[model samples]
Target: MVAPLSAWPWEHLGIFKYILYGPLAAKAWYSWMYEDNILKDLWCIHILLICTLRGLIHQLWSSYNNMFFLTRNRWIKQQGVDFKQIDDEWDWDNFIILQAMLASMASLIFPSLNTLPLWNLKGFIASLLLHVTISEPLYYWAHRFFHKPYLFNHYHSLHHSSPVPHPFTAGHATPLEHLVLCTVIGIPITGSILMGYGSTAMIYGHVLVFDFFRCLGHSNAEVVPHEVFNKLPLLRYFIYTPTYHSLHHTEMETNFCLFMPLFDALGSTLNTKSLELHKKITSNSGKNGRVPDFVFLAHVVDIMSAMHTPFALRSFASTPFCMRMFLLPFWPLTFIIMLVMWGWSKTFLFSFYNLRGRLHQTWVVPRFGFQYFLPFATKGINKHIEEAILRADRLGVKVISLAALNKNEALNGGGTLFVNKHPELKVRVVHGNTLTAAVILNEFSKDVKEVFLTGATSKLGRATALYLCRKRVRVLMLTSSTERFQKILKETPVDCQNYLVQVTKYQAAQNCKTWIVGKWITPWEQSWAPSGTHFHQFVVPPILPIRRDCTYGDLAAMRLPPDVEGLGSCEYTMERGVVHACHAGGVVHQLEGWSHHEVGAIDVDRIDLVWEAALKHGLKPVSSVNN
Candidate 1:
């Protein structure tokens, strides 16, 4: 059980907790319809409006800061926000929700706020003074107070749990802490109103600015320019930088001021290295770009997937991709993006992380999956992939893995074209299929005698058939072409040739319990398998689960090593901290420090070798995604 001090009263409600505010929203809507002057209902409405606006501000800052591409070099914490931190700060806006209730109650108790003028210049000026003299010092002292043992253990530690603070982390606090924060924040607005001059504009402006600064400070990236601080050296004393507050989290003993560094200086608690480190970080921003040890070359699946990128909408990207009612409105925008990027696009960095000590980043090809099918788009896609390879080679990237459609044999011969075109290229271009085949073939235990196969002539399928034949495990290769079957059969040893049986139709495997689907199979096609058949796939856009009795495995993926840091976004539909096997394959290549390019045909001999390397480096098979 959670301690009373750490748990909120509504913690058990989960996402359903929003139902608490449903009545208030309905009341506001009802009042708007009936009331002639809606200003009378502004208090009720403002609560919802401020909550929505504040959430958006926090989200925008988070999206920018957490998108590894934008803040790669400037990250305050050189680590990915893990599942632990994400869950801890999941409901970061609970403070605002509680404040909505408190503010509504305060309005009922005091009627003067409802009748205030549209704009009060005196109140605006007073709000500034009140925040400077009152909110700042009070928050500073209260923040300092929480750092002491007892309160720190219970309340403040919740906020501090996220060492690398995202903007949402600004509000990830215990109820007691938020209550104190609400008081500190409310002081200026309440003070200005009681001074008999507070107005509508003053209330909105002060609160929004407070939220803006808070979000900006915890952005986890140095967005404030060093040039600005250099120009006005004294401005550093008045306004705090993200780096300044970051030290407070890392160092934990100094820079206690809320929005200003003035109190930290007066309190004699400013970190000595704060300004120097801030300058070093901000001055070097974009001077020389980050070079990764490994690069995962990826592409968007469709227009909908374009909106699901890390930088697009962070909260959305954090979860598994699926259709949401909220995303319906953004379809037109993403469609426009697909059109605009189709012709004039180049590969760009998407996300990054550090594993052990190696830097790994994902770079995206601008082409969507459908476009790769278009004859016109194949050349353009290959061009982008080539440009990315050249960039990686120039940056001394040790290994670059081609993912999904980006490495399709038809488009660029599984990246062999690029490797051949640039023969002197130092970077090892990997299609990662050797490990992919290992992951698929390993799915069948030693007890399994035979298995059904689809798309048997494809590279991964061919490699699987050859590997299994060596083990004397019969492979019912599904292919109509005698030439392709004989070619693959010849590759296997003379003794194992009988184990590779060529079948032209799905009905050949009616008694087979293991169905290794390497091609798209519809409901009618899937019906050929017996009830207990498990589908192990290497197919893109994994086939749908149609039969209730038969189970479906996730796409080939590996849980990244526990030591892997800063992997924030889920790769496609894989879970957090889990990556596609191909991605893990490239990481293994780099870890093993292999010099050769892993492209074109799958290397059947190295299947077990790569799997062992992956296992050695702590990458575990995530064959069952339910795990």
Candidate 2:
């Protein structure tokens, strides 16, 4: 009779021990004999060595090969990745230490799992095949189970946190989830041992192969050569590329297999976004060379208001019963935390396209109601501004301007918080208040001798009022507090004082030809002005609705003349003649290519500079008399 199949040479001897062991053993012996006594502790030394080597390889792959991988087979047409939020969550050094400790503990508990001198080629191949087949199904179900509402919020959410996954982030899961994954990975090795097909070389080799694929799946960069899939189409069915796994992270609905797309295709759970994104990135589009010109950050007031809703009805309706119960009692705390987190996080709104001048693109980031109230919640507002600046840096935007109350709130050091926290960012933060003052002042012409100005106590309001007074135009200032009005009067120039008229009531300036509403004045109060009056609104969330008879205009930045090279649309109506001065200030800096322009105080000197810049770009006031 023929010998048992297990007695074959190929099944009993492997390359790792028979061929490569001499050099590895010699090095270990030398270290223990002379280099370091610590090497005598074989288990400790081996674990530390393996962890260090793995870390170095991971770092090198992540830093150097990432771009090469992406460019070779890109899935997205983006220039940079936003990993700032992920960095905040995971500390790499701590993670490395923890991983090393865990490996050491595992080796101590199951010493038989340690790498040995046994070599079995047949066993290695069989064990690897078993591991792949068994683990694929086990991982698929476990991954899908984690997506269920009950476990997702508590555990799996951590792994899904990084939308743009990096290689190191593959293992950034919660303790419970990590344990479950480790158990799944061990099933094939255990099975091979029970079937008398396991060897030390096979087990260790399986771990190495498994980790290699795990890192590749989360690399966020596609390295599969285009020719491979084209010439050998069958390989695509067997191998899941980085692009395939990235879709699972982004879409979060499909592509649940660990190693191959077999299970996903079999279950009809594969996502098409991966293929679509790949096609788009590889297509010969005209926008291949274009880059972002500017980035803006703005907040959504409605979303902030919705967060404080009682019972979290929106959140509860979206989750399963288990998560709903888990989230019930913490409603009040959740609301408060949401309120507090507003100052710490930023939400990217959209990108601005077709802007005027050489600068043709811009990005808008919303701070979620940070601009609603001014000066009252100063600390929280400043924190939000700082976060936006850092986010801009992450997006590779070199210059960022605060809009509306953001400019006013951070007027203290001209965004010192951003500058201090992110000194290495190479980004400039501007309040853009100077251009705002300029655009509003430009509204007043020689035809108007007198004007009504509300919100004079505010920074922009006060600056606009003083600018009008300096122009020798009569100014009627309306404010809530008489004491503050008197205090401002003391700082007014003697000649300007002649033009300044203090009034506590809206009716006091009804007869004025022009009215500048620079604060949150109500519709009723705005209606109190004369029927044919011209209203120049400089406040955010403009209090007055557009009227048919009355001409309502906003302070705006002027666009470059059509004759200028690379001129894009100003994205504002020419009927208004100008855009918000704050916006114009940003445009001016973009034109001048200055990366560190600050318009904090909006002093007369800064205002003159912006006014000159606006004129150079062909920006001027519209005819207010016609209104």
Candidate 3:
């Protein structure tokens, strides 16, 4: 059965139009009463005031609707919307203001344009028709020209920066491009005036209508009901909708019509995606699926960090030159190596249905054998992580978390090489190490005056050791090198060194009441720990086996509120009985809907915030660790 077609609410339309045009109409009426010849002074202060008011009102309306209305409306789903893109739109508002000022100056310079009479019904109809006929084809061609490679990169690309468009976005173009657009739009009105078939009222009315429809086209919210098109199918060819213009922004090569769909149909440039989306948005079937609030990319170390293996050696057989030179001989070996690695590494979707009723997904890219200890191998591993990140991005992941060794490789700049190399991905990358450090420190008891710390030279280890020293806790720093330990002491505060004891031997750490393992050490080295000491393991792919005597803890996990639907079982060993601080940090940001890099040297305050969020989510310490 066909649904009954309904007419668009006249009152709603009237209210919307009047909000924009009321101020312009009042100014025009006041000017008409004072001036005997309105068109004689085209640069009149009243007209300039009206243009400024129109621009200001248009901006205000767009902001209010996009922020308050369109974002919440299910029909205008916010899945593809990028906040960075919205920020760019706000930046473009300055260009729009400049365009308005230039428009007023153009009026002052051109006295010949002031030829239109104040009131003439025949002139009004002729001017309106001429504008529709002339501007449509000109705008279509000008838009297509701007899409050419050079122009697009320089000018028109700003307009197409966002996948989702809002009303104010209509004016979000480069100044030169805006001028070109204005000139094209003015052609028909100027022609009508030269032919003596234009009126001042008609010119102003046409501009009001043009601005109104342009805003509507970029609103991203469909205001026109589908039933109207269903009832009168021919009207679809006559008018262009917001969905139609969105395709031009998305697909970037089609639908170049200004205010009419006639040119688009005739030129065969109409996009079918727009029509399909319009139908889907207006029907019941489109409303069922859920859109993820946040997405993340995570990379885990494939091989143990101690191995210090070069990635080129690990992937030597797969290199292009090796494959070409050896052909069949290398092919079989490469296949075997790839099969083994594929079994070792994997990408898993970590879906979180949290306490606040938010659904988020994190793409965990576990690197099986990409680990390397040398500086040169860091780039190879980064490249491997980059490929995984790009793959996640293709699946619509919005952010990425560099976990464990991934964070170590990306420290200082937070995967900047990947970001700089792949600007097209637009995914936010963060090192989850900050919160991981916080969770580890939180495990230390207040009564413990002395602590044994390993991996003292590592970034996280250094940061944690410094923090512990600052709190007046006696720290016995254990590392493999005496030179590195001396360097660390020299970098530490004068008073901090007094409380810190540097040692190259595991036996020196035996007297310490608390043990924190920050680096990978052999299980045989674990024999030096005192019988009753608390053991905290921070290293991923944990080095020490779980013991019966000591309280062993890793990172904390974000506990799901039992009632949420579609909850998945915990996967990571660190998250099996307890969550890792790094994993918890990613989950916290995902639940709160923030995208940022948390890499490099982490501060104590950020750690506190993440730990607090973990506590709020019901995360608790897992007493047992995997061997």
Error of 1 at 93 (Å): 0.5
Off by more than 4 A, model 3:
1-293, 299-357, 369-380, 388-398, 410-416, 419-427, 482-493, 546-549, 555-565, 574-578, 590-596, 616-627
Which runs of model 2 end up more than 4 angstroms from their true locations? 1-293, 303-346, 352-366, 374-381, 391-396, 410-426, 486-491, 546-549, 555-580, 618-627
Q: State TM-scores per candidate.
A: 0.95, 0.46, 0.44
Q: Kindly list the per-residue Cα lDDT of model 2 for residues 1-627, writing each as its tens digit.
A: 422221222222432323323344465567777865533445555655655565655555454323321242353323223224334333322333444556566666766544443666777766767766787888888888989986787777777876556666775666566656667666776677656666756656666667778777776556665457679877766788777887887777799988888788877888867555544544533233343455544443443232322113312212222222444566676567566645545543232333453333333333445444555666766766676677666656656776665655434455555666666876667767777777677766668899898878777777777777788888888877878777767777886788888888988977875988877777677767778888887776556565666787754545434433322112222222233456567766766677665744457656878778767876554433344
lDDT by residue for model 1 over 1-627, one digit each (tens)? 555646677888988988877867987888889878776666887778887888888888887886665577787676667666777788888878898889888878886667889898999999899999999999999999999998898778888889677898998988888888889889989999988879988988887889999998898888888889889999989999899999999889999999999899999999999889998888778765556899999989877777887778766677778778888898998888778876658677787888888889889888888888899777877888999899889988999999988889888899899988999999999989898888887777779889898999999999999999899889999999999999998899999899999999889999998989899999999998999899989898889999999999888888888887777778878887888889889989999999999999998999999988988988888864354
lDDT of 2 at 582: 63
Candidates 1 and 2 compared by TM-score, better number: 1
> lDDT values of the candidates?
0.86, 0.59, 0.60
lDDT of 3 by residue, 561-609 (tens): 3334422223344232233566556666665556565555566556667
Looking at candidate 3, what is the lDDT of residue 272? 71
Best-first order by lDDT = 1, 3, 2
Looking at model 1, how many pairs of residues clash? Answer: 2
